[model samples]
Target: MGQRVLFIGLNYAPEHTGIAPYTSGMAQSLAAAGWDVGVVTGLPHYPQWQVHAGYERGHQNRDIINGVPVERVPHPVPGNAGLARRLGMEIMFGLRAARARWNNPDAVVVVSPALFASVIVRLRAKYHGIPVLAWVQDIYTAGLTETGSAGGFATRAMRAVEGRFLRSCEGMVVIHDRFAQYVQRVLGVDPARVHTVRNWTHIGPSTHMDPATLRERFGWPMEDIIVLHTGNMGAKQDLGNVAAAAARADQSGAPVRFVLVGGGRQRPLLEELAAHAPRFEVLPSVDDETYSALLGAADVLLVNERPGLTEMCVPSKLTSYFTAGRPVLAAVEAQSPSAFEVASADAGMRVPPGDPRALLAGALTLHGQWVESGGTRHSGGARYVREVLSRDAATKAFIAALNAVRTKGHAPTRTTTIATLNN
Candidate 1:
């Protein structure tokens, strides 16, 4: 029989954004490669933060998606829950995940973001003599501290708990080298146990569309320079800076319009902040076709981060932006992973985070280039996507890492066994 593996994560298929895509992609690829794969995941309720259509909030069910069986558990869909409520939800999901049917398997892969869930699942699997490999999407402790979401005492406690969870795993996979360094230095994990696998663009191909026609379709201004930012508008994004820049653009008559598309805990706050800025608009998230159309229609794609949010995550939006073959302008720390991706790909320019003036200036500069060059400046981002972010390469690397973990076997667990003797 082929090797069997189970994936435990809070997010999975049907949610195309954030950690869901990577987790779903990895599971499907493994199933396609002849490994017996099953997933224990929550009902789809990611960037939208609400249960998807046809899915109930508290129902537990089982089904197959793309040839892989999944055990879907229900958890609270918090739109803007406080830190305490959010942690409560995570713990609830973790407890339910531990109760999910466990297929006898060679190994298990635990996806983080639901950091507490990883620990819960790992301990459960270890009890059954199964080795687990952690797929760290974002550092939980770093996120809490960097976003100022938790106090110093709380952050330090989380760090210790999270570190212990990761150390107990057989191996770990991170999306970037910077994350691996943080794991080794701050979390005190063995360097050899960590692996790096860059995330691939999960969006469909973007085609060239007439800017005027798309602008009309999306109800955007025809004459204004469009600087678009898509995906989650959470605390880490610090989109308030973008609103401030748009207000400045309006005052200076820069002919620039800043649009944010997507939903998150911060959307209402962003809407209120951008209320007075004429050039700033917030739109609801759209379907894939409209999303692609919007990307093709924009003069520049943008990424904005909070001032000190240096290492929590590498925005998944960059992969899509690069695939759209448009130039990017990032308002992030100079040494962040987002800045590195932009600079290394020669795809766009970066300005200091939280500086509204710098962001506006950078957008204007990209706009000038677009106008002078007739939008023909196809940046190196697309090429980087092809050469470095290929889905096939990523999947193969993940499978190899999984196999390595499986081969090591789980540490011996002391379990009582009853024996019968016949006279």
Candidate 2:
């Protein structure tokens, strides 16, 4: 048999969440690269913890997505904010994934944010004598702590556990360079063991939609300027500033209208605030077609991450925004690596995070500049995504890392030294 690769992820398609796209894209890419690929995942029930409309409950439901075998195993669907229930879900899925591997022993990759799942993969790797690659989308404990979600003794214990489990992986894939550095400096992981594989936008049909069609569909005034923010609206987003900016822009008699899309814990509150502002519109969660069309309707894309969260998280939406070819008006920490990327690409401007006045000022400045130069928001970053961040490029990098691990004939070593950042 050719080299078989197994991918373990918390979310997979038919799930409609952020992780699903990445997991599905990576699986397809690996399959296209000639590796026999299998995905072990929990039953589809993310964002809404109920089995998707049609999938039956099961222990080993197998299906083919883009020619790769996907095995869906049963796991609990914990409601949001129940620690015990959430941990139970992770443990159940982990056990099922580990058991599934016994029948198909192969090199494995584990995606994280499910802390218990990482532990399970480590144990399974050791038991099966298979190599393990830990794909670190976010620094677990640090993310919780930075977002104020974990605290006191709980945070300490979780950190200790997370550090140990992360160090056990045969290889680690990180999305940000700062995270790689933090992992090396804090966890003593060797730099070489960690590979920086930034997230990419999987090219899809209809990425570009006609602006007039989008405007007509949304009932937007033909001459009004639209500034859109799309993605999960959670505590980490700090959207009050976005509202304040909208109010400020409106007061100044600017034609700019703000559109907020997607749903999360903070959606209700954002809706309440937006209702009081005539220039702002809060849209219900939309299906992919409508979502992409909405994005295409924008004059500017607004990205806001909570203040002080730069190193703790990276918004995956940036890739999509860039691919959509819209000028970005990002409100994030000045020091954030994401800010650097936006600035370096000359896509748009970045203001200090959580500063409504500054956000308003920056938006106005960009609007003025766009009008003065008679230039529609245009940037070469979409070309960058096509050339560097496409699914094919991500697959090549992923396979190279996997091959390196397999060739060493031993568990991969870790290195802490920083490398040049890839755009």
Index of the highest-TM-score prediction: 1
lDDT of 1 at 263: 85
In model 2, how large is the Cα lDDT of residue 264?
Answer: 64
Per-residue C-alpha lDDT of model 2 across residues 269-311, encoded as one tens digit per residue = 8899887998888886567666666666787788888888767
State the TM-score for model 2: 0.88
lDDT of 1 by residue, 346-412 (tens): 8888899999999999998987876687766547888999999889989888888887788776445
- Over 4 Å off, model 1: 208-210, 371-378, 411-423
Worst 10 residues of 2 by lDDT: 414-423
Stretches off by above 4 angstroms in model 2 are: 47-51, 56-60, 82-85, 203-209, 250-252, 376-378, 407-423
> Residue 156 in candidate 1 has what lDDT?
95
> Cα deviation of 140 in candidate 1 (Å)?
0.8
